[model samples]
Target: MTMLILFELPQVMMMMMRMGMLMMMTTTMMMRRMLLLLLLLLLSLLLLIMSQ
Candidate 1:
């Protein structure tokens, strides 16, 4: 029982780490997309102002 518990502990920690990494990656990707969209909006606004 003790050995089984010890073996499972590392697996659980590894699973948690993987989950955390996935969440971080997903958030980073979303932020990058948002930044890109904001940049595009700014560029369009600048173009409009320049045209006027």
Candidate 2:
């Protein structure tokens, strides 16, 4: 029973770590996309100003 518990502990920890990593990666990707969109908007505004 002790050995089974020990074996299961690492698997559970690894699974948790993997889940955390996936969440972090997806959040970072979403932030990057948002930043890109903001940059595009700023550039368009700048162009509009220059044209005027």
Candidate 3:
């Protein structure tokens, strides 16, 4: 049983690492989209102010 667990431990660790990487990728994508939206909003506001 000890040997079995030792073999499984590496697989579990690898799975956890993969999950973490995926989560980080998703969060970064969301942050990039939010930044783009904010930039667009700022640009539109500036344009409106200039037009006024």
| TM-scores for the candidates | 0.90, 0.86, 0.98
Candidate 2 per-residue C-alpha lDDT over 1-52 given as tens digits, one digit per residue, 9 for 90 to 100: 9999999999999999999999999999999999999999999999999999
Residue-level lDDT tens digits of model 1 in 1-52? 9999999999999999999999999999999999999999999999999999
Instruction: Kindly indicate the candidate among 1 and 2 with the higher TM-score.
Output: 1
lDDT of 1: 1.00
User: Could you tell me which 10 consecutive residues in candidate 1 have the lowest summed lDDT?
Assistant: 2-11
**Global lDDT of each model?**
1.00, 0.99, 1.00
Model 1 misplaced stretches (Cα beyond 4 Å): none
Runs in model 2 deviating more than 4 A are 1-3
Compose the digit string of candidate 3's lDDT tens values, residues 7-46.
Answer: 9999999999999999999999999999999999999999
Task: Go through the candidates in order and give the C-alpha RMSD of each one to the true structure.
Answer: 1.0, 1.2, 0.4
Error (Å) of candidate 2 at residue 41 is 0.4
